[model samples]
Target: MNKVVVKKIEDKEIVWFKNSNSYLVLEPIAAAILLKINKNNSLEEIKTWAFKKITAPKKVVKKFIEDIFLLYTVNNTLKKEVQNNSGTYKIPTKYYSEKYYSIHNCIFKIQFQTGFHLLKIHPIFAHLETESQNKFHFNYTIFDDKDFIVFFKNDAFIGKWNKNETHLFEGKLSMHLIIDIYKKPETDWMGVFHASAISNKKESLLFLGDSGNGKSTSLALLNANGFDCIADDFVPIDNKKNMYTYPAAMSIKKKSLKTLLPVYPELKNAVEYHFKKMNKTVRYLPPKNINYHLKLKCKALVFIKYNIEVELEINSISKIDAFQQLIPDSWISPLEKNVSVFLEWFLELPCYQLTYSNNLKMIETVTKIFNNDL
Candidate 1:
């Protein structure tokens, strides 16, 4: 109700509301009540109006009000601001290239040759350097967007771009850059794993599982318990077999909202997204601190599987089994001649398989593992 703005687009079915840090989608009924929210309108008045307008039961209307209030009360929500700098700078048509390494030291060199200025370098790579500016340049061009050849070097996958869909095109391009950085060939010492990592500034623990297997939930719980999240969804592993933080926003699915809302109240105002293919809703929670610890030696690895029917259970697993489980979801450097060395280093760490329905106990179990008490 406070500092919230609602607007209906011309042809869109869902109404949009701008909260402090992110935009929220509202159904027609919810939008009706949201549009009527004002400083003068009391809760009783809004509820009465909503019930009369929708012909729904009072309890249902009350629930809607509560949901809107939860979103309204969130503080310090992360926001995305768009800057329009079009037509301000000279647009080059010739070939231009940039090279840089991520915080985890994944090397990337992107070459762009275009006559159109609409396709500015991906915003994420704007701060990175060109090959000429950096001392070291990778052997292959990670991304090539020239007129004749527009594909990722390792995969040879070309992307389609349109001038009218600049925002969508740029977003896809950014995703490609992230993938290339994680799977670049020249960075033999680094690899990307499909896991979540958290640390206590001394040692890091990794949670490996498939998508929707509660990796983000575990990371969020760890964050609430005095631990810092290194990465969620995808983490980088260095030459020393250490897990490094990739400071992207943690994507929390809708089902985990009730579990996380109490721990992270700011999530109430997180940006909501609908994944059509997955048929699930998700929200992105920004990191607590943009500046996080970059390097962390992996203390342990736990393969987590959520089972609602069972309580917390922890079992030690063989290193060979862990290696096989990790390989399927991970993206490693192609130039790495021998995979055995990486596997050996990873297997040296303590590994376990955690199955639990209770999130609180899961956190406790993980804490005990880190302290060597479990």
Candidate 2:
């Protein structure tokens, strides 16, 4: 197996250009692997080096590599890179919060803020990096061969981890921080919808479709061409009705290459197959305006359908019918017993069901709707 090289780019992202066209956003475990392998170290040397650094048993180092590789296989999209034996590099951190944890094709870092009962990943704005740059927000006293805990300012929450239960608490606490602390607030402040939000300057278009309906593919194609990609799989809309965006960019699948090739011929070889479940996958973030936040209402909703016979047709559906079609695709569902809030939010926006055959003409058809204000 060849050693892969890792380089630190931007402030948060780590790049491994040799493996795949896209960058692998590192978790602490991945970062630790990179630190173990410098440019000169061979695979055997890496095993020996790991044993030297930590006073573990002889087989610990070998198993460590194997276990981490398995993790990447099951939970990570970088499984192909590891399988290909492309030498990889990682940036290590002692303790980081999962809220700021941006894994390759899986999650997004919504917001990183400190509270009385929360653990944080990034520095608290500024002020204390010089004091103890390695210090963490929460007091994480647990350790697996691959996991580390950073202490947080939340004294009460930190106290929950009794000695025997510390490891379990570390995983639980990270999850709690992400859901109760980060996602709950962000979802309220910005209504987090499970749809792709694509925009130019004047008009922002949203594609609300059932899973595997090419929601992510359409967004990726638009992004590759010229328009801004707000969010590939999930969109964030503010309380005052402004939509904020985050970067979770990926690419289209190889199977769908025929649909996209007519519109954008550049993605021929660029189409990489990701085994993960996300319909919209970011293979690379080429030079394009990544819209971090967009203050636009849900101007138009287009339901996308792909087939061989139908030419691209964007028809105007009645408001009631539009709401019925769009509701099913929303993050909130009628299946949930309590859906008042979701129905309220849904009524405020305009909706459309766009039916089309698998041709490139849908782009122009949708463009005309925006022009006509239908």
Candidate 3:
């Protein structure tokens, strides 16, 4: 009997580590070994069992199995949920740069203590920046506190981000915005996906891939062709499974310069920012034709890649494999009910692995998907 929730999807199994609010996708043999982990299974026995399942260096395999066993099979508690609460740290509000934005008709006044923190988030929402004499629904303040970058929602202490972990900072802000826009608590969100998403007005198509796998570049291409960019980097899906709009700029990489040059000629002279921590150079491209209040059902989950070796190919991938790729990079709800909803919505979605080299054909295939032609 496994202590965690293990669901079989095709050839892989997703092991839910509820204690840590985490998940692990395993190969069959690893899954078998993981289920059997306990004091009863000796170190040598588990390592020997792991040997029969996969091919690797004996010393490497032994170390890998030993680490896994010690991490889970031992009495040591599994990795717990990391809290980002701001404890004992306080900073005065300077609000040097202030702007107001309206999302879903809700006004939010965003204030930055310095321009450094402002540029991290301001560019994407620049289009939404507006002048308001009306009362703000919330005041989001971000400031550098020497050791960490702190965030506040309506002056209430929420959380702070580690200096090295800027993604956590932006991600938390994105979630807070989602909560404010939907008028729901943080737990109401089904999941936040680390993917670039675009829509055809009626519905959406979410592109999931590792960083530098052409997710944002594909979005910039599609936006030029026909689709509307919904969200980039952080996409939120509600409990009902509808994908809401996240008004943010598309961070296009330097390698995509020649490819998108024809579509966006102005990008040649666009200011570039080097994200040193992430080791990626990017330029922000504002989204176009987006519906400010649109909430759309997704039509497909595409794991895209720009492969110069091949012309173009779009193939159906196993939902299990897709979930394995998805779960690790995503933030799923810890609540049991919301987890159930996430699984239900995820399993039903059509998953595809799209590899393309030709721009026109890639756009055509995506258009066909939106039209339900494929």
Candidate 4:
């Protein structure tokens, strides 16, 4: 009974729904049910239509519709409040300095107290602040009765904040804010990729792999060899297929400290963080000679695998295979034109699978591939 916009992305095998400021991804069957909803359609009519199309039973369809209705109602209410409260804020108990930054022309204002040591360690954002109009902003402040809170412009709390333990909470809040500002529906970016990127100044190489597959290690090695590090974990691709550098600190695991320390002596002073989820100790190090604001066209896609028992090797793969491997880790924009342009740029790149044990051999193989010698 609610008004919503539904878009079918047949190429991606997913349907997108935009309800106010919220976006939801639904499968074909669920999407069909959503499409059946209209101003005139009763709940029984929608259920009857869904049963005719979907193979599910009457009870399953009923539950599905109930879930969708709940989600839609909750998200719609939040979206309306967020939109109405934009550019308005309540005075905080403690005011901090507001810093402005420009990323792909989208402005973000981050306000944090000088005592918040977490902000000081994030050197990647050091050079990004400049005189700019604020498009999105969040304020970090502490209260007399409560703990620290990162408040949205509407004074809505971003997340749970504690005064005693603040590092991990603030770190997550910062990432959430970054994603919010960069991945807005009105932005021109195609989408975000869970891949690391490095450039030779002329063209960029994107390294895609699973979470523990050495993407950051490979990028660190390339950076040590004079390649410009574009992004460590998430790469933002514009509508034009240009990859923008996300200069977040690279998280290097303790296992890699022996090999990477030789190349980057600065890692000796890097702060150690124990990631409870991964059960690993990591050091967040700033990429070497990184330009915080740089965009490069992707020239190659490499799927990397690090194996202690395997010899170094690089093999070419078809575009179809590359796409199949990349789709799982990629968050493609629901916009039809954006998806088309991204596919064009992606298919134009040469794809390769690189397996290696030693970093030196891996570097050599990558260099040869880049030079067309492989």
**Highest lDDT: which candidate?**
3
- Those runs of model 1 whose alpha carbons end farther than 4 Å from true positions after fitting are 1-185, 290-293
Residue 161 accuracy (lDDT) in model 1: 44
Off by over 4 Å in 2: 1-184, 224-226, 259-287, 318-321, 332-345, 358-360
- Over 97-142, each residue of candidate 1 has an lDDT whose tens digit, in order, gives 4445443365555555442331244332333333453543232232
User: Which stretches in model 4 have alpha-carbon errors above 4 Å?
Assistant: 1-92, 95-186, 318-320
Please provide TM-scores, in order, for all candidate models, with all chains considered together: 0.54, 0.47, 0.82, 0.62
**Tens-place lDDT digits, model 3, residues 143-170:** 8877789988876887877878987888
- Please state every model's RMSD to the true fold in angstroms: 20.2, 22.3, 4.8, 7.4
lDDT for position 185 in model 2: 45
Candidate 1 weakest ten by summed lDDT: 9-18
Which pairs of residues have clashing backbones in candidate 1? 98-130
Model 2, position 147: C-alpha lDDT score:
27
Residue pairs that clash (backbone atoms under 3 angstroms), model 4: none
Residue 44, candidate 4: Cα error in Å is 23
